[model samples]
Target: MTDRAGHRKAAVWGAGGWVVGVLGVLVALPLAARDRLPDRLATHWDASGGPDSSMPFWAATFVPALIWVAMAAAVVLVQWRARKSAGGAAPGWVGATLGFGGATLLGAQASIVRANLDHTDWREAGSVTVWVVVTLAAAVAVGAAALWAGHRARVTVPPVAGPTMEIPEGQRFVWLSRTSNPWLHVTAAVTGVVAVGASAASVGGLTGAEAVLLAGPLALATVVVLCCASVQARVSEKGLDVTFGPLGWPARRWAAEDIASARVETRTAAQVGGWGYRLNGLGTTVMLRGGECLVIRTVKGKDFAVSVDDAERGAALLNSLIGQRSRG
Candidate 1:
């Protein structure tokens, strides 16, 4: 399936699972509490059937579930409207999905506990509600602050709009600004999110549940390794910056003068050998699935290569610029 389809499918599955989980909780609560609470309390009263039961089933579960339903509805509405609009505004579904989906899972767990366990009184439920509200409010505040800061810090970066071949004269340093493939950008974004999320989830203290967090890190590391394929060589007047691990920023730089020659080439997974940045007997390796390479020969008689998308065009551009530099 296409990546977009996959993302949509995952979202649908998550929502579906949440609905199923809610039903499971509803079914299990009655069974789990039958022997523990009186018949009136167990069947007619709150799910727990407790004394001084100030809150009813509808009061706790009904309200939250309705809120979840409303949020989901809003997500659909916003996305539909966004589709009719121009210029890709960050989708409202992003926030709605993250917020409602997360809240549903958490809120459901709290609901189940309150319904099944007598220890979880209305006071505890109130506390949980307060905590959730406070946390949500704090998150909004922080997000607003971050948006303001980002806007304040934002600076316009003009495209490299001039002649493709002409290297600006006497330019001590110039950062390459080029539009990469949209698919690549999407892939990078997904890989980065998975890697970062897994890393965070891997940390202890998240939950007492015996979740093997190490799996997150391992999965993150693997995705990071694969995402390194997108980084095109970054050209500067002094040197070229090539990525090492993941589709993140490059960590290695090779001087322009050190480069003996640059050419466009292709390689298979075998030719690349190993992951991460590997200096094989061939050249500097950036991507594992080698299709196009920007091969560079360092001054030390070692050739380094970075596998980039549209490497031939990139090589030509670099060659033109570098050649211009040599002449001037």
Candidate 2:
């Protein structure tokens, strides 16, 4: 790498470190001013901007801070991995993703703190509807700008393993394999259960406007969790189809005609920059646990790889299918 490129990368890494530090500061800010906060902090707000749920001062203040810290830590970890990745932060979006994480989390929590801090009486609650919307919008704008900038960075495609087998033209075959990471499901389930409990607990005393506010978000979160649980991959004459368990069809499908080549590529957390639906300088990938994956290069030159068992046979069948279309 050139000296200039090395310096630029170092800058990205430094920025990532700063982001972590900033998040820590954000978490500390509310705790520092605890004396002014109400005995019960308004942790959950409804659409009408009223506090729908609250908790004792210390718990409310520290709990969200802990969760935010965890969330920040995760982003920094991913950013660190991406920086250490080949092509000098090829995932480019690392900065943007990190930015979004920091902004969204800190911004939201700051609003919550504001709502509680201004309460004139302990029993009275403050509205945070505007805060929620404004903070989220600001976070998104910052993330988008960061994302666009990250995309401008050089794109890098990792090396792929050469083909080991071929399929004959006369024979026709179908290839299908399904793989799921139990850990992913467990994580999703735990998250869903926690969300349900929290949602129920927060709105227990809420009614009408306040209840509706939390209800929409809780419902949306359940759906998102269900979608993130598992993935399924299928290859046929039509082409490759990958579908998330909850959202079947329409989300992901690549036509056979659009495919340029398919091969069994070795899988590593480093190569895809860690698992679970990843997008790096390489094309999008649905990678579960590490192993070998059938990587497909589309005619447009975009690559899509899925890490699964028995990738060799799957790759061979996909190649054969592509070749058959080429000849016919």
Off by over 4 Å in 1: 1-84, 87-209, 212-232, 236-238, 243-247, 274-279, 288-290
Clashes found in each candidate (C-alpha, N, C closer than 3 A): 3, 1
For all candidates in order, the CA lDDT equals: 0.46, 0.61
Q: What stretches of model 2 exceed 4 Å from their correct place?
A: 1-173, 206-222, 246-250
TM accuracy, model 2? 0.45
lDDT of 2 by residue, 1-328 (tens): 4323433544444444435444454556566557667677777766666667777877765676577667657766776687587544546666677667666666666666666565655446667676667767867886786676455334222212346545555544455555555445444444444343333223222123554566566556645644444455667668877766333422578888988998887777687887577899877777766778888898999988887666777677678788888889
Per-candidate Cα RMSD to the true structure, in Å, reads 8.5, 15.2
lDDT of 1 by residue, 254-275 (tens): 7666665677777665877754
Give TM-scores for every candidate, taking all chains together and pairing residue i with residue i: 0.51, 0.45
Error of 2 at 298 (Å): 0.3
